[model samples]
Target: MTKFKKRPSKLKKFLGLLGPGLVTGASDDDPSGIATYSQAGAQFGLATLWLALLTFPLMAAIQGMCARIGLVTSQGLTVTLKNHYSKPLLYIMLLFSFPAITLNIGADIQGMGAVAHMIIPAIPVSVFCVAFTAILMFIIIKYPYQKIAKILKWLCLSLLLYMIVPFMIKQDWVLVVKNTFIPTIHFNKEFFSIVVAILGTTISPYLFFWQATMEVENMAQSKRKIIVNKRVLGDMRTDVNTGMVLSNLVMFFIILTTGSVLYNSGIRQIDTVDQAAKALEPLTGKLTYLIFAIGVLGTGLLAIPVLAGSQSYMLAETFGWEAGLDKKFPQAKAFYISIIISLLVGLSLDFLGISPIKALLFTAITYGLTAPILIAIILHIGNNKEIMGENTNSKFSNVLGFITLFIMTVAAVALIYFLFK
Candidate 1:
């Protein structure tokens, strides 16, 4: 009896430690992310594989700052911005984030519908998309935050398909390691677009807002005061670093799996997860289809809510309304409504007859163009000790954060240039 009790206690402690990072990291591999990675693998093979390694530190630094900011201030991103910065900057930042994030949500909803079609061919894709959107919104409104988080956490484990499917395929280890360790690049516009896609996929701005708000939710779950001491900040950094590393590792496997299976076979095109799954068939066998479906379904489950919730957080904070997943819908009506509105708008896009594949690519490029501007705001807020206190970013973190911002901005500009010329 004593041993069993101790075992449960240990398990509970371990589970408690995994909060924002797991949610943020799991959400990172949303449908759009998978598309970006799959496209990279299909179009560029293992040449851009090194981006996964390169994105690690940048993502960690950005998300860790967000988490630290939330812990210190106990506020959402827009709320913090409003309270500390001028309204013009807040409004400008909101303008950039709102459109990019809404587009992302629409893409996720469309992707979810696409996956539903893959799983249940008889069901109309539009119906499934609207139904899925409603069901998710209903769950958020009816369920407690803890329940929602737990459900998403379990769903995230489905992404293990990326980890498992690679082993089932015949991989060229020599070339795989060579491409991973030895960097490769092409100066052409397509190469630049792939770079932009990778940037958009890994360093997404919504994750920053989501991580901060979720950290506050995590603290509320434990009934702990939001603390910004050295110990708390250290723990937050560890969580962010762990999550970022896991995210990039997943990115690595995604490209490796697709590159090894699809690109090596001269299959140069993919749009939806189904296409990617079909591409995986020759090397990974029939089971690969099952793996791909599970990955999409699982990641969609994890990601869509964060997308909705982050939008909810920002809008509520912007208008001075009560917000937080922990709050009951009656108490946070504005917040919940904002979430549903974003979701429904997203769902409606699926019915517009836009190709799911095209939506996926559009989502990546749109977000990529907007991410650098948002990152600059994040860097500014994170470095201000008055807002972050002891959790303020170190000089090293600030430098890395700005470098990431620079790279993203440059890639986005290059993408635009190629689009016209």
Candidate 2:
């Protein structure tokens, strides 16, 4: 008699489920995002810690819908919009998207370079920036999707340092617990601005494009004979939910670390990742500071590719050119060229005299304005029976999607009012 095969362990099954969703969610807490969250914690203390809990469900819901669209349509979101929507509509999105994504890349690169310079004062920030740029470009051009994805997955380990930080220093467990569960709102422009920044940074527009497109790419790279079925969608949800939870947890801990250490130490008005790291060195000691700074560099390594890849994919899809990270340079010349150009442009931002802090703030503003519109579009597509067929969003997804849309729309309006007020 044949022996029965042993089942795979639960932990192995969980690890196998991680993919595009994992990368996409981790990339959300890029250097720029860290700076935004740091600024919130530094300025307002634990007032914003509750946002991490609130955003997880909202973030997971939106990403889950995008992933589903990619699996069902077997096309990038840009291509779907081009095929089904008006030309001007698609172009408008690209116009808004390209600048924000490039600025974000430049900001992340600058943050990483700044933190690296902090670690090794002998090396210049410019040199570190150039070297990191070259290394990332080489990796993207040289490796296939699976290898690069594995590299990113490992890079995610760096974010856990943020979670490890608050434990190193003394934390008021009771106060932390109280602040996390209880929402606090201040009726002022400054407080609202940080709130908007947090919203814009966490619920970014770039991740939307990346999530849908990478889902398509992830499927293409899979060795198994896969089909878009309930199991597949279920796996996608698990991956996305797990990733978003990780992303939000990192955000929570960053705020907690900064809030407990810096705020209590009378430090406020922190700008940029380097500033946050530098402040931590004195207050929380060298070890905590290095961990925080190093996480910035790791996130840059993980995120810049996502930013550059998403931009390149959008351009490729808009123009009807072949594009995939799994494809070689000769196979996808336009796509690879676009990625290279975006990296070069981002690298030039510092040489052109733009500050990383300014880049982060401006990028947040741009996203705050554009993200709601994209959410509206994603919601429309998710619910479109002609497009999604039988896979249209369920009531649970629709409820979360509408809630996200409503909240983001209100934030966008508040942002505009604040900007012009």
Clashes of 2: 0
lDDT of 1 by residue, 36-152 (tens): 789889888888888988899889888987887788888777788888878988787677677667777787777777777877889987787888788888888899899998888
Model 1: lDDT equals 0.81
In candidate 1, which residue ranges exceed 4 Å CA deviation? 1-14
Against the true structure, what is every candidate's RMSD?
A: 2.4, 1.1
Q: Backbone clashes per model, in order?
A: 0, 0
| Per-residue C-alpha lDDT of model 2 across residues 16-47, encoded as one tens digit per residue | 99999999989999999999999999999998
Judged by lDDT against the true structure, how good is candidate 2?
0.91
**Leading candidate by TM-score:** 2
> How many Å off is the CA of 117 in candidate 2?
0.6
